[model samples]
Target: MELLKAQNIEKKFVNHLALDDVNVSIPENSIYGLLGPNGAGKTTLIRIINRITAPDKGEILLKGRPLQPEDVNIIGYLPEERGLYKKMKVGEQALYLARLKGLSKRDALKRLKYWFGKFEMEAWWDKKVEELSKGMAQKVQFVTTILHEPELLIFDEPFSGFDPINANMLKQEIIDLKKKGATIIFSTHNMASVEELCDHITLINQSRNILEGHIDDIRKKYKSNIYEISFNGEVEKLEKSLNQYYEIIDKTKVDGHSAVRIKLLHQTNENELLSLIIPAVEIISFKELIPSMNDIFIKVVNEYKN
Candidate 1:
């Protein structure tokens, strides 16, 4: 089931079209990546989704129905720009935010304590927000973002301030959230994180959605029929065997094993490749090379610019 769907979402500023007929569907219990280059309208679309701004010409649907003002209570958002009051005590501010989300004081305190403990932040309870490090403060905001147990959570650059240890800790928690059925819309410039965590994604470019699909499917769609073959044989024989069917991209020896990367110049199956090369070299390993998200991002954005 789709927890949220924004169809034909359009937004504009005096002289700028921030979003143009953008459409996104976020499935229940899945992490959706809201991706694009800077100024490509990712945050504009995010603002629309969070009701921070109304679309100029589109509607948002939540849980298969028209989105309502009250739906904000059920949707948690942690913007890239953090807004915690520096002078407020960490635990006090957390409880305040939880109550604003409509939690009772008793319930808010209970949940806040639990999360503080889970994050090993109980010692910082009485400390002012300004007293903690940026990463520690982000941890508090993270706790508040999820304290309500919102059904849909939107996080923009949530990993910004953390070290690898805390970042990985947060990543695992996000995966855990999915397992427990919370739909998430994650926006970031980190393509590697998207490759690791996103089940589906929408790539926006020039105020438009240029790519949208399951992560695996999108990667396959952009595949270039490249493969890396590891073998032990004379490089000269391997080169002769490639002929016109292959384009050797890079050849290097890995820990004494000969590895060669080749791009298929013509449409050919793995069997055909093996048949052509088996007689020339001893095959130790073979694997197709799928273009990484980083490569795909550059390709798509550059093409759009051109």
Candidate 2:
């Protein structure tokens, strides 16, 4: 079921249309990727959903009802711009933020200790925020953001400053959060992360939503009928056996096997291609070459531009 829905959301800023008729439905306990290039109004939409700014038109529904001011209590938001009191000690700042999120002092301390220990940050608890590195500060902020265990979490560029190890750690935490029934709206320019973590995505471009669907379905829709075949046969013989419906896009040697990428033309199906090639070569493996999210993003954005 959809936990959050935005219908016909529109936002304007002094002659700039930040969001135009943008709509998205985020399912319960799933990670929804809010994607777009820089200045494509993704931040504007996120802000509107967080009630940081009001929309000029349309409505936002949380759990099938009109969103209210109190709804923010159930939402955890980590904006792209990180902020913390530099002079305050790490533990002190975390406690302050947790209190603002309505957590009891004892409960907040318990949770903060657990998170800090898990993140190997026990030593930095008493240190000032200014003394920590960017990645270290980010860890503290992340812990505080989800300290109250909000049902809905919005993370904008969550992996921005972390190294590969820390990023992977954060990724696993996100997956764990989903398993624990938290619906996440992850906003990032990282397509690889989107593919790895997002169950569904809405691609916004030029202040409008251009694509929206499940990751697998979107990849299937954007596929180009390309197939990769690894067979033990001569490249020339394989090339000659195919009819005009097949076009060889790439050829390489994989572990002494001739691997070739072929594009099916004129709506030629896989069965037909296999039927023709089976008699001529020994088929070791065959698989469709699905386009990645990065490819689809570029293709869709360029098509919309044209």
Candidate 3:
């Protein structure tokens, strides 16, 4: 089921269009990546979804109904620009935010305590936000965002300040949230995080959606039919045999072994390629090379400019 959807969404600021005919459907209990370079309208779309701003020419649906201002209570948004009162104690600010989300004082305290313990942040509760490091403050903000168990969570650059260990910890928390029926819309430039955490993604460029789909499907769609082969063979003989059937993209030798990458031109199975090369080389491994999200991001963005 789709937890949230923005259909043909368009947003404008004065004379400039910030989002143009954008349509994205976020599935229930899945992490959807909202991606693009700076100025691509990623933040604009997120704001529209959060109802911080209205779309110029489109509609948004939450849980199969038209979205409303009241729906904000059900969403937990951690914006790219962090906001916390620097002079306020971390615990105090957390409790205040939780209450604004409609949690009672007692329940808020319980949830805060649990999250503080979970994140190993008990010692910092009484400390002022101004005293905390960027990463520590981020942890406090994260706890408040998820304390309400919101049905929809929007995280814009959620991993910005953390070290690898804490980032991994947050990643696991996000996965856990998905398992527990929370749908998340994550916006980040980190393609590595997208590959690791996102199930579906929408890529925007110059305020237009250029690509959208399941990660694996998109990867497959953009595949160049490239393969890497490793084997031990007389270099010249192996090259000659492979040249007969495949376009050799690269060939390198290391540690008494040779590796070659080939892009198949004609419809030929790996077995067929193997059959031709077996007598000439000892095959060690053969694997297809799929383009990574980083590659896809650059490719799509470049195409948009052209």
Give the candidate number with the greatest lDDT: 2
> Model 3: runs farther than 4 Å from truth?
243-245
Global lDDT scores for all candidate models: 0.92, 0.94, 0.92
- Model 2 alpha-carbon miss at residue 210, Å: 0.6
Tens-digit per-residue lDDT, 53-77, candidate 2? 9999999999999999988878999
Q: For residue 265, give model 1's deviation from the true position in Å.
A: 3.0
State candidate 3's TM-score.
Answer: 0.96
- TM-score each candidate: 0.96, 0.96, 0.96
Residue 269, model 2: lDDT of 98
lDDT of 1 by residue, 170-280 (tens): 999999988888999999999999999999998999999999989999999999998999999887899998668788999999888799998888777788888989999
Writing each residue's lDDT as its tens digit, candidate 3 over 178-251 gives 99989999999999999999999999999889899999999999998888989987768877776555888888
Model 2 regions more than 4 Å off: none
Going through the candidates in order, what is the number of backbone clashes in each? 0, 0, 0
TM-score (C-alpha) between model 1 and the true structure:
0.96
Q: Which pairs clash inside model 1?
A: none
Q: In model 2, what lDDT does residue 244 have?
A: 92
- RMSD values, in order shown: 1.3, 1.3, 1.3
Model 2 deviation from the true structure expressed as Cα RMSD, one decimal place: 1.3
